[model samples]
Target: MTDQVNANSYLDTDSSNICEVLQILGAKWAFLVLNELLRGPQRFNQLQRNAAVIKTQSLTDTLRHLEQNGLVLREVFPTVPVTVEYSLTEKGSDFQTALKEMNKWVEKWGKPQQVNGKTSISS
Candidate 1:
């Protein structure tokens, strides 16, 4: 039998430390939420609307995850009725720089393509 070659063996896993970073940011709606916040702080509803591509449930989960990760801060305004808004924390701002670099990489190197019109990417 012929030897089977593995394509991934050629890659240096350590060089892709950013993979973990991207994984966190790659969660559904996470990037979009960050992109929205880049514009400025916004209410929950605004985020939901801005990240319309993500399901409402997914967006909710993404926001909670980001908040838990200390990348996003949730604020409550004391008024007759409480108003909630989300803004990026210092950590999140630092992450934005990474994301910007990632964006530049994408612009220079073509984005991953869809195979057979399928919407997902496989390892």
Candidate 2:
């Protein structure tokens, strides 16, 4: 762990005090939603389409959670159908560094696990 992360008083990184925020981010589709936003801003339907496995309701719930945590910004434009865009905030953008590290770790150490006859990656 880096000194910066270790010095962050906001997060109790100790094993017994795992942050609740981590649980929120680890929620279904949350990481994927954040990952997609890292590429650029996207509309609701675009996120749904790009994230094929996520249902509409799941995406809605995850977006709400991310927004609540100040990781995402939702902008609504006054269009005919009311276009809504979601983009990462500065905090969220900073989080991408950690995600990139996690991706590297997964690629190196993760193994495939079977779930209902399908292969899924697990560490």
Give a tens-digit lDDT track for model 2, residues 35-109. 999999999999889998999999999999999988999999999989999999998898899898988899777
Q: List the residue pairs that clash in candidate 2.
A: none
lDDT assessment of candidate 1: 0.79
RMSD (CA, Å), candidate 1 to true, equals 7.9
Off by over 4 Å in 2: 1-13, 112-123
Summarize candidate 1's per-residue lDDT along 1-123 as a digit string, tens digits: 123234454354644865867667777678788888888899988888887788878978998989988889999999868899999998887777877787777666755668898743332
User: Which residue window of length 10 is worst by lDDT in model 2?
Assistant: 9-18
State the TM-score for model 1.
0.70
Per lDDT, the best of the predicted structures is 2
Clashes of each: 0, 0
